[model samples]
Each structure stands twice: as structure tokens, then as C-alpha cells.
Target: MSSAYNHARPPAGAASLPAPDDPVAARLQESARRMAGIAVFSGVVNVLMLSGSLYMLQVYDRVIPSRNVATLIGLSLMVLCAYLLQGYFDALRSRMLCRVATLFDAGLQEHIHTALATLPLRGAKPMLMQQPLRDLDQIRAFMSGMGPTAFLDMPWIPIFLIALFLFHPLIGFTALAGTVAIIAMTLLSERLSRGAAKTAMDLSAQRQVLADTTQRNAEVIRALGMLDRFTARWSRANERYLRENIRASDVSANLGSGAKVLRYVLQSGMLGLGAWLVVADKASGGVMIASSIMMGRALAPVEVALGTWKQLVAARQGIKRLREICKATAPPAAPPVELPRPSRELSVQNLSVVAPGMERPIVSNVSFALSAGMGLALLGASASGKTSLSKALVGIWQAASGVVRLDGGALDQWRNADLGRYIGYLPQDVALFDGTVAENICRFDETATSDAILKAARVAGVHDMILRLPDGYATRIGAGGMSLSAGQRQRVGLARAVFGDPFLVVLDEPNANLDTEGEQALTRAIQALRAAGSIVIVISHRPSALAALDMALVLYEGKAIAFGRRDEVFARVSNASRQIAERQAAAAPAVARRAAAFEGAAS
Candidate 1:
């Protein structure tokens, strides 16, 4: 939803293609039209491909026998010109295909990025999701390589066969039979290898996912002595992938070899047949060579196709997956309306959320309302639904039963980009991208001013700490902030959450990794946000982090146990705990007295 995208339109040539409801179909149609232009050049190139055979025939039948130097020279010049034209056409075709690839990427890159960003909300595993960009690269590489050229040359096979018939019917028949046999072999290769190739791709994806997951938690794996176990699991997966890849490659290689041998035999057979015809006064020696040459030309594409079958199959599969992903994540028919900025009145009515693949709701029947200049603390034990409710409020997780609204409008009613500008969220796990400290504090917005970034850093009380880094705001962080300690990363994320003075701020476990100084800064930031008429919601298990909040909500077993003024909810929880403890103390004495009486009676 960037402003630059708001008024963007497709290129003029794309207008001729059918603009179907499916964007993927439309893109493919446009691409095909562009490829059609390249196909025209391919036709010219293939025609020129026959020049070599014709030149040989001219030299043997006319120039050599007549001993005409002028005729030979003329033929040589014409053949040279033909070869040059063929090269030009081939180069043009390659250029056109590259252009098409560039255009295809330009058309789909944004959609793919949007899908990747939104998929996690729908419970997608980031590692398991197919990478459209990589798939796009596969398609482009195939288009610009021999794979597509083989397909383009396939249609010219019959033309070569006709030329062979012109030489002699027997030679033509031999070539035709060779063509059929090669075609059959190509089909066999596809049949034998497709299943294994697909399995290889799937296993490769799984291996990549495992590798990524383990690397992301390298500390835990190393500390717990899980490296050997992980390595064995990875080795097994890699072996399976390798096995499938070898199976597919073996099938393709055998077919390719068979095709080569068949072509050689067929060419030699045509020559022998032509020789017999010449002896029988049915054909000429010049025609024999010409027929063999034409026959070989016809089979060359088949050989190339067989050799590149694996790439072709893989590209086809990649395209299919990309299409499916595009369809699944297509934008809505009508864009959501962009509403005016909210005044930070947050409300949740009977909200419920069930985690992916779980039958029970993680957060159920939770309700709350907070106005501008007010703050709410979400207090709960582990697995008590505090983080789930926080996610629901921020529109990161959809509620199953009810609604979360800002300024009387449901969260879904607002365009994500517009709504995001006024909302800030700090998740339980603080992940900062690899960039400068200022970039992370400013949420990596290119247009953010230095003043805005410094202000947020000050608000989060990390300004002095950042200044102490090697290069201050310009210091580079490693992937996931590996260059910084946990406390530093948490502080930076806190600054990001409050950056831009958002109207609604939600921080989940913000103090989990913070020291005393960081904790105090967080309390002051909450108070400052509330004073600025921003509604702040903090989710924490530590009571110290809740001191500055105006109200509190206690969640127990996915249900709201209490919600009201902060002191009131705290008092209720404290009283409940006191009553339970007293009852336990009274029952302990009675049980001890009973045990004593029973022992005395027995004695």
C-alpha cells in the first residue's frame, strides 16, 4: 500500500492481453504474447539452419563436378550471409526472452512480497512456503537458455523431414522413423523421471526448512548438546533428496545417451540407403550427404531437449507452484477503504482466538475498552492468553468470534498501511533486521527523519546506549540483531514500537530482557504515551511493569478473570490468593489431628 503503488499501471503492451480476474493468468497471457514475437525470430533462425545442408549439396552436385570456381565462391558467400543472419536472429531471440523475464519479475515481485508478509497471519510456516522469487529465477534462467530454444526448434522437425524426402523417399522414411523413436524416448524420460524429480524438490524444501530453523536457534542447539541429533536428522533428509535427484538424473542421462546413439545410427543408415539408391541409379551421391545432414539437423533439437529435460520439468513445476501461490494470495476484488486516523479508542468485544491446528481457543470471550490518554496492563501466568489477546488487538491474529475496533470501526475496515502508521507493536520475541541502529529504531522507513529516530531512541532510554556503540546510530547489526545482546535488542525494539508517536501502542513482554534502567525507561515511556493521548497496552507477567498503567485485565485459562481499575483487579487477585492460602492452612491442622487420633486408637 505504498503511495507509489496507488496510481501505478501496467505497461502499454500488456493492455492487449486478456485482463482476466486472475492476475497470474493475465501476466502469463502477456508473457506468451511477448514470447510469440521471439517465436517469429526463431522461425527465421530455423530456416537459416537448413543452409548448411543446401550449401553442401550445391558444392558436390554443381560446383565440384563442373569445376566452376565462380559457382563455389558464390555459394560460399550466400552460406556465410545465411549463417550471419541466423546468428543475429538467435541473439535477438535471446534478448527478447531476457526482456520478457525482466518484465515478468517486475509485474509479480510486489504481489509475491505482499503474500509473504501476510501469509504468517494465516498460520503459514515461513520456512515451508515456496519462494516465488527463486522460482521466478528458475523460470527466467530456463527461458534464456537452451531449454526454451529446444521447444522452439521442435516445430521445425517436419520441415527437415520434408527436405530429406526431396533427397529420396527412403532417406526421408529413415529420418521420419528416427524422429518418432527419439520422441518416444523423450516421453519415456519424462515418465521415468518426473516423480523422482518432484520428490527431490520436496525433500530439498524440507531440508532447507530444517537447516533454517536449527540455525536460528543455534545457541539452544549448542548449549543443549543437540547438534549431533540435528546433524543426523539433516543427514537423513539430505540423503533422501540426493537419492531422488540421482534417480531423476540417471533417467535423463540414459535417455540423452540413447537419443545420441539413435541419431548417429539413423544418420549412418540414411547414408547407406542413399549409397544403395545411387548404385541402383535412383539417387545421386550429393543427395546422400544432403539427406544425412538434414536428418541430423532434425534430430539435434530432440537431443538438446532430452539433455535439458530436467531443467524443463523443474521450470514447469516452479511455474505451477508460483501460479497457485499467486491465486491463493490474490488481493481482494475491492480495496479496503482508507479511514481517517483514529483517536486511539480501543475496544474488544467477546474476542476469541484459536491457534493454528488447535481445537481450543487460546483466548476466549475477552472484552475490554480503553480511551485515549489511558493505558491497560494485561497480566497473566504462562499460557494464560495475554499474548494472544495482544495479537488480536493489533490485527496480527484474526479473532474467531468477535471484533477489535479502533474509533468505532472494526480493525479490518482500515487499510493495513494506513492503520499501521498509527499502531505500534512489540512482540514477545524482539527481532531486529540487519541494519544500523537508527534504521531499526525508525522501523527501517527510508523517509524517516533523523530527528524522529533520535526522539524515539530518547523515549526508550536507549539514546545514550546507542551513542556508546562503535559508530553510534550508524553501527551495523547482524542478522536478527546478533551483534547486540538480548537487552540491547529489546530496547531497540521498544524504541521502534513507540516511534512516530503512534496512536495505539501494544508491548508484549517488553521488560522480559530489560535491566532495571530499561524497565524504568519503559514505565516512563508508557506514562509519556498516555499523557500524549495515545492508548498504550502492556502485556507482562511482572507486576513492576504494570505500575504506570491505569487499568488491568487478568486472564486465566483463556478467560478474563478480572478487569477494571489497576488497583481493583490487583486487590481482587490478592484477596483470592489469600483466601485459598488460609483454607489450605486450616485443612492442614485438621488432617494432622485426625492422623494422631487414628494412631492412638490403633495403639
Candidate 2:
């Protein structure tokens, strides 16, 4: 579980890849364009405000000669222009910002979903994906508060300052100084935000752990009457999250306050200096007023830029992660040569698999051949490489040294999509989505319509169960299909694997949750597949189940301890059944006690 959230650092230099076409970058770009337009409009609005005030002052001073009709008309037009410019820019910025936010949310959700689908199988890793989703929510909240000004207007701050300098070097230089100070303040805020980001990530992982713990031990917690204890644990997690948030906010608030104060002071000081210049006739009154207004306008973007400072950090992380995913090595590409069409006969020679990191081979010097209409059973204890062997055979896990030949060509010569189309797989842990019963039964393949779905369900012997539900095939299954009992879920999963009429099918621990009737249905289905000349492979430890298999292999400590016809393997392990039964008898009381305890807790 700890390893799952340990944020595996990309190998050295892998993090330097260019940003991909992610939603965040798209939002930033759109925001940039909108901010550019708004900045121009804002500049025009500021110019009008400055011009209007100066015109009224000129009239009072008799420079333009006070005129009731002309002056009122000119002022009315100026007021209208200012209102129009300000309103237009404000509305434009609001709409653009909303669009950016929506894009951000959509992209984040899509990336999370894609990552879940693409992540490699890592045994026993408690999933940390839920944390990223939570962080994205926080990011959305922060983005909404800052508005388009934070990111979009940022690039314009320097340009506006330069424009002010062109208007008057003195005003521009002073604004530049203020800009530097604002940047320093933002840097401080950013440093403080680092702590917040780390804390937020940690809290998110911790929250997941707590949630899983509560779920896994729900029965225990309830039986022990420890709901209050669990609640306290959750309350503590929330408090820590709150404290970290407050610390981040305190830093940001101080930085904002300081920037605002410094801007005001700089403007006031500029005014005082401009006043001296005006009295000395070195600068005109209009220029002075214009400089004062422009001074503040120049600083406006700087402050907004500072406010969006945290986003830069988050964006960098997001892009780096996106790059890592894009650059992930996919399963080796298929060879240019085409493979023979899949046939009933499958064979492997000198097979050896050494997974990416580990030193030793998981399965070595293994060889076997299965003919059409034949079924083989694999019996092994957990961690004995039985699953790995199955994966290697299906090309999910590559063999380091060997040939996996289906029909008469190398497995690598066959396209993955084509192979998948002809092969059906049922992993030990059945994964179902939050969809209707029919959808799950069809495995979300649109081609499997009502008739096809019902047919598959009938074959798996779960059709009657579906009819028992109020909504029948349309009944909504909760996440992971928790709504269905274990046996029912397994049957549904089996129905899915067998739905597409594949040439070959693989079932991993298919009988794990099946009752006597369910087991019989599976046996009958396997026999039917054999009759259709389709090969079937089953992985399990039940001796009773081996009677249906044409051949069997017994594995121990990652080695094939025995292999042959069912009679031959049984002759070698005739005592194996008695040994298994005795072991179960010894463990029964403890399991029964735990079950009782769990039920009591839940009640």
C-alpha cells in the first residue's frame, strides 16, 4: 500500500520530456489569448478614464473655456466609452475563464481514467489514483478564485510596463521596481505553497487508506461497536487537511496584502514626485495625472500574475506526469510479418520468463502442447508463478527466452487486437464497471446487443438471476458490481469472456466463488467449447475439478513438479486431496470464529 502512493520518480532525465497536448496546456493557451484581448481593452478603458478627468480639469482651468452644451456632450460620450470598454473586457474575461476551467476538469478526468486503464499489473499495490482526483478538485477551486487574470494576463504585465516606460521613463522605471517587489512577494508565496502541495498529496493518500480500512473492516468495526473510533480517525485526517490549508492561505494572504500595499505606496510616491515636476513646469498637469493612472494600471497585471503563481508549479507537475505516461513503453509492437490464423493447437518451446526487474526466471525450460478440443488445468499455490505462466501464454507478459507459437507462427507476429478478438480471458479478480447488468454481461462491447447478451448469460447460467432483479438486464450495478453476490458476479464475468465466440478461452480460478450448480454450469460450458473445437485452459487447485480436463500440470515453488494426463498426475498426487482436506479441517474453526466476529461487528 505504501509503495502504491510512493510516487515513483521517473528514471533520471525521463522527466524532461516536452509537454503533451493536455487540457491544462489548452486552457492556458486559450486564457492567454483572451487575456491579450482584454488587456488591450483594459488599456483603452484606462486611457479614456485618464483623458476624461483631464478634459474636465482643463475646462475648470479655462484652458478649453467652460462650455455648457459642448462640454456636457463630450463628457457624456467619454463616460459611455469607458463603461462600454470596461464591461466588454470584464464579460469577455469571465467567459474565457469559465471555458478554461471546464477544459481543465475534462482533461484531468480523462487522464485519470486513461492512467487507470494503462497502469501495469503490480500485485498488492493499494491504488492511489483516488488521490489525484481529489487534488484536481482543489486545483479547480483555486483556478475559479483566481480567474483569467492570474494566468492569461500574466504575459502582458511586462509588455504593459514597457508601454508605460515609453510614455514616460520615470513612471515606467518606478513601475518596474514595483514589479520586482511583487515578484519577490510571489516567490515567497510559492515557497510556502510547496509545503501545502506536499501536505495535500499526503492527506489525499491517507484519506484513501482510511476509507479502505473502514470498508475492509466494516464488519469488524461494527461488531466491536467502534464506529466512534473510526469517525475520530476521519476527523483527525480532516483537521490535518484544514491546518495545512490555513497555513497555505495565510502565506498567500500576506503576500497579496503586501503587494497591494507596496503598489499603493509606489503610486503615491510617484504622485508626490510628479507634483514637484508639475510645479517646476518640467511636466504638465495632464501628463502627471496620466502617469498616475498608468502607474496603477501597470501594477494591476503584476499583482494578478503574482496571484496565479501556484498554478505554474501545478502545471509543471501535471505536464511532467503527462509526459511520463505518453513516453511509457507499450508492449512490443507486432512484427511486420503476418501470423497464421489462430488454430486449436497451441505450443510453447523452451519457455522462460524473467519479469522486468527481478533477476531469476519465473518459469524456465518449460514446454507443452495443447491440441484443439483439449482442456488443461494448472494447479499451484499462490505466488508459485501459475498466473505469470498464464499471462506469458496470452502475451500479456513477455517471455524472456522462448517461442509461444499459435497455429504455426511466432506470437509476436500476431497483432494484439487480433489476438484479443480470438482469445477470451477471465482473471481471478473480476472487474465490473458501474453500468447495467446487460452492459457488464456484454463487457461494454456495443456489438453485443440484447439477444447476444441474453444468449451469453444463458450459457453462463446467470440469465435467471438477472430476471430476478427489478430492472432485469437493465439493473444498475454499483462500482465494481458490488451489488451482485460473488458467485453471480463471477458468472457474469464468465459470460463476458465467452460472449464473443473466441477460438480459445482462459479462466483463472474460475471456480473460486462458484457453488455446486455454478460449477456444473462451468463444466458443461467447457465441454461445449470442446465440442465446438475451441481450446480451454483452467487454473485451479481442486482435484475434483481436474476430472473434466484432458491434461493437468501441478506447480510448486514456480516449478512444474508434475505434468501429464489427468490419470497420470493424479496417480502421482493421490494423497494430495487428503492433505488439502486435512489442512482445511485444521483451518475451519479459526475461519468460522472470524466470520462470527465479522458478522457481530457489522450488526
Candidate 3:
């Protein structure tokens, strides 16, 4: 166990990645630098894009009029070279964008996973816990697709328009009007579809939550004959999502169609205006055709931009959501202190905890201290705050007020991952990840040794039971240990709680699913843990489990009623109950006689 604990920390001189709080900004900065490089390449590509117009001009103006074969051949070769360069630059920019996306994922994936794991500690519902990863993928896809290229080419629109003006002012003015019209249509599309898009996204998230819940509880739904009800509920949610999605798509499609029509009109109008200019002797036939081509080129990015507007909008929303989540889940600013191994001293100083959205504290002003080699039993009825108190002790739930400390340091003083090395907890819900029994016993620590795994199983007395399986410790368990019986799951969780020489262990309802033999094993596990100089805290409703504990704390309505040696606290509680019973028994005869007299008089 000690060997496993010792190997958990990284070496002192190892290269450290950026802290979780810094990764979002660091990744953004890195991506921006890459985008800057791509932007330079885009400028070159746009410049080379004018090769076709120039080629047309040379062919009609110089080669055709002068009938010079040498000049025509030379111009064709130049145009070919220009197209080749443009193709190369375009491919390079696309590759750069893909690389930027990869870097961004590398920087943030681990941090997002860490936040998701710790979100329950903040009492968050985590309804969309996996959404951020999907959002990251969305951003990556947009960066590599035509959407970003459209934006990059947008600035070159004015350059093309300027070239058209030099050819003939009428052509330039006509093209400018078309550009303004397209811009107006784009804005209108955003205005009409923004609300629908947001609504659709929210509905989709709700549908995902419902689907996840139904899948996880398929057994319960089938057993209770609730399949039809769940299916109907999901169908309604999905229909709403589809309706809003179609509405938003319709608006976008209309705008895209309008932009395409306006683009064609502007191109034809430029040609007609150029012809009129030629007839009026303001320009030649070569200038007429070249000006139309330039006008069409100027408006191309706008057409593409309007066509991919939905992707741009979605990417914008994804960015905003990612920023908000990262901010909300950022770790504390202060670096954690590196403390020595604790001596198993547990202290709770006036601790209070209230459930989320509730005014009443579930555990209020509770204080206790236990030394090494001692075991304390918390005896309470259902909803008596035992589980909440246990959660606070192990640092899963934050205290509303006061502090819980190991040795002499408050829980928050140590880094959570570091503190976790010396503490273990078994929650009421015996959830196990999809893995082998050995992996679960070692808390899924990759560095854990086989000896440590075997020792933990032995301590929990689940070794023989594990061996009975076909693959022994190597047997695979399904998600949430669905493959195991309730008792087996609980026992495996117990082994996990005592895996690595932890100084403080808290088990809530440890024997809830255990049979007679299993309960006896649990008693021995507690005794062994105590004899090893560890502090053991057990929350149990059964009196038999409490027999092995040396001390007891009795609670009622979130208040501690008694705290002392087990026999003393139990005696006080029993005496108080006996007195109340005796008083009630003595008053029963008088009340009965008075009721009889009243009945006799009425008769």
C-alpha cells in the first residue's frame, strides 16, 4: 500500500504542463499565431487569383489584335504558373488550420476531463458535462472547412472592386450596389434565425439528457412497464428540436438563395454596363469582359459567406460556451502546500452543510475529534445527515461553514489529488467503472502494484469471492458494475476505500447489501484498519455493525445528541426513550377514564 502511495506523485524535475486555469488562453494565443501565418498565405493566394482575368485581358487586347503568337504563348505560360502557386498556397493554409485544431485539442482535452470529474463536488447537475468536448470538435471542423476561408477572402473584395473601377466606373458602382444588398440580406438572416438557432440548441441538449437517463435506467423502465411513457417523452422533445432546427435552416436557406441570385445579377449587369461603355468609346471590348470577371470575383466571398452562415454562427456560440465553462470550473489560484504524511488524526470544527437550493443545513455546527487507532460509528435514522457529514470528512462536499482537518491542516490546504492519496471514501452508491476487479481495487491508479491490489482485496475479504469468477481479478465489470450483484459491488467498493495505506477512511452504509458472512468480513476489515493506526469512520443504521466500533455519535435532526464511548451513548439514548415511554404509559389510564365518563354522560 505504501509503495502504491509513494509512486503516485510525479518526479520533482518533470516538465509540467500549464495549469488548468491557463490552458484556454494559452491555446487561443497559439492558434492566433498560427492563424496569422495562414492569413499571410491567404493574401498571396488572393493576389494570384487575378491571373485568369489578366490572361483574358492579354488574349483579347494584345494577342488577338496584334496577332502575335509568341506573346500569346508567353502569356498562357505566366497564367499557368500563377494558378500553380495559388493552388500550393491554398493547400498550405488548409494544412495549417488543421494543425491549429490539433494543438487546441491537445491543450484543453485533459483540463476539460478534469473539470467534468470534479463538477459533482460543486453540486452541479452536469447535465451537459460532455458538451464541451463536442463543442471543441465543432470549432475544429469549422476552422478546417470553407467557412474560415470565406472570411479570409472577404478583405480582398475591395481590391477586386478597385480593379473593376479602374476599368469602368459604371461596372464598379453596379457591383458595389449588389455587395450592399448581400450584406443586408446576411444581417436579416442573422436577425430572423438567431433565436431559433439558440432554441434548437437548447432543445437538442434536453433531448440528449433524456436519452442518457433512459439508457442508464433501461432495466427500471422495463421492470416498471414505463417504456411507453419514456418513449413518448423523448419523442416530444425530439420533435420540438426538429421543428426549431428546420425553422432556422429555412431562414438561412432563403438568405443563401437571395445572395446567389444577386451575385449572378451583378455579374450580368457589369457586362451590360461595360458594353454600354464600349459603345460610348469609354472602354474597349477587352476591358468589357475583364471588368465583368473582376466584379464577379469581388462578390464571390460574400456568396460563400452567406452560404456557410449557419456554421459560423454555431462556432461563435460554441466559443462563448467554452469560455463560460472554463471560467466557472477554473481551479483555485493558490498553490497547494506540500504536507507530510498525516498521522490519522481527524477533526471537524463546527462544520455545517446545506444541500443545494435548500435553506436548512443538513448538518449544522457539528464538531468531533478522533485519534489514530480509533473507530467511530455514526448512528442515525434515514436523512439524519450521516452521509453528508461523511462527505465533508473526505472532502467530496464543501462545508457551508467551519473546517475539516487531517492532522493539523485544513482539507483545502492540500491539493485535492494529493490529499486523496492519504484518504479514502465509500459513498452510499456503489458505482464502479467498467474495468477489471483489480483495477477497481487499486482506485484505477495506473502506477499501483499487483501486491497492493491483492492486499486490499484480502483486507476486504473479497479475495476468495473474486477468485471464484472465471477470470479472477481480471474479470471485466460493466458500467456501474452492472455485471456484479449488489453485495459484490458493495464489497468491491469497500476494497477500493482501503486500497493504499490511507490515514482516514469513511464508509457510508458499508454493510447495506452484505449477507451474514459479508457483514462479519466487514467487521474484521474495520478492526484491521483500526489496528493499523488508521482513523475509521462508519455510518450505519444497524446495531450489529456498531458493535465493533469503540465510540459512537448519535444524531437527530442534524444535531448531535450524544458523543462518547459506545455503551455510554447507547445507554443515554435508551434511558431517554424509556422515560418518555414510562410517562406516556402512566398518562394513558387517566385519559381513558375521562373519555369513558364523557361517553356515559352523553348516553
Candidate that would win on lDDT: 1
- Each prediction's TM-score versus the true structure: 0.92, 0.77, 0.92
Model 3 RMSD, rounded to 1 decimal: 4.5
lDDT of each: 0.85, 0.70, 0.84
Best-to-worst lDDT order:
1, 3, 2
Taking the tens digit of each residue's C-alpha lDDT, what string does model 2 give over 423-465?
7788888888899999987778787778888877877777887
lDDT of 1: 0.85
Candidate 2 RMSD to the correct structure: 9.7
Look at candidate 3 and tell me the lDDT of residue 535.
90
Q: What does candidate 1's lDDT look like per residue over 80-109, in tens digits? A: 999999999999888777767666666777
Off by over 4 Å in 2: 1-69, 100-112, 120-172, 212-240, 278-289, 329-341, 349-366, 395-405, 408-417, 575-603
- Backbone clashes in model 3, listed as residue pairs: none
lDDT of 1 at 370: 91
Q: State the weakest 10-residue window (summed lDDT) of model 2.
A: 1-10
